[model samples]
Target: MAKLVLTRLGGTLKGRALTPNPLPRILWRSLSTEGESQDPSIDPFLHSAPEGLAFGRLTGIGRNTLKTDVIHYLEGCKLSINDVKFDYNRAYTPVGVLLQFPSRSSFDLAVRQTIRKGRLYKLEKIDRSEWDLKTSYDGKAVLLQGVPRNALQEDVERFLSGCNFDPSSFQTFVRPGFPDPIRVAIIQFPTQVDAMNAFCVKNRSFCLNNPISMRVLQ
Candidate 1:
């Protein structure tokens, strides 16, 4: 985004200057917190999602934007929307949106229209190939690294439930990633004990398989 400053002198506009706007404090803090919050020993690329496209990423918009927000903005512009459909994707750097357009021609048309008419915030076509590198944890979710991008959602969940970690208590949200060699995931256990076992400890070593702190379980 650009910052515009209008100089007013003697009740008359003197000149106008435009410059790049600085990133907001809150957003910067969140990105910076990624490293601070995660375990330093866990490699950034270690548990990265290789298949990458778990969710589509869109640019030229705020990370927190919702589908209705875009629809309302477009409606204000009196734009036609009979041919387009979209959804909100996960938040990422710069900005991102999850969009599901019906056709390629419609997608391309949207690109041109948004660029030309969207004077405030431009909307980019939703793409499936782009993925997010910001993987997050709630401290105890079992982390599974080296996942294949082509793996099915069911398969991923099944793997987590069937792992060495006790599966009886495994009833939670299994989602994820980072940008390393392959895909990464978590087992979504309800308790630390359920995520731990003979595999988790040996000779006073903790290996819960998660890259995050797990509440300093290390």
Candidate 2:
């Protein structure tokens, strides 16, 4: 009869044949568990925000803070925040949060807005706190060149309908030396998302007698 060798039975093949090593099952399992623990996915590497993405920080965050509270606060302020990626704890325990925004304009607006203290979410300020804006913007206004000098404000607004742009926000600028009758019109939108959507009208026919080109300034 074969003798029990740790977790399995071991028998000699013939006379003087050596038995298999008698390693304990617990030890074997421990080695396998250690291998699994070394998986790269569970690594504790500290990652920073990637390039081209706007980043911001919110302090005084608690473990009890819910994602819903953050969403509600953002929507309440009409912030066109979209596709925001979050990292709760860059450390062991929950300290605060880091936010990454795909939309630079949205990030600019959000960091400038005041977030009032609510039931669950708390901040250092008793009344309110502004999200720390860590990025800069060259500009967000749309510039339309070669606009017909004769086009009225009402005519421009009609062509820019559904773009959420304020009718009174369009301004015309003309170079003093250049004698070209064409004028440049700069239009501003309420939110960054609106500015993004403003590009959808690029192909739409703006004038019948004049040539015009539009571009969103960085």
The TM-score leader among the candidates is 2
* Alpha-carbon RMSD to native, per candidate: 28.0, 18.9
C-alpha lDDT of residue 87 in model 2 = 31
What is candidate 2's lDDT per residue for 88-150, written digit by digit as tens?
Answer: 221212354445454556555555553433423332221112224322111245666666777
lDDT of 1 by residue, 48-148 (tens): 62322122234566543444465564443332332222322331122444444544454555566566865554555334443232332222344444445
Off by over 4 Å in 1: 1-57, 74-94, 122-218
Whole-model lDDT values for every prediction: 0.42, 0.51
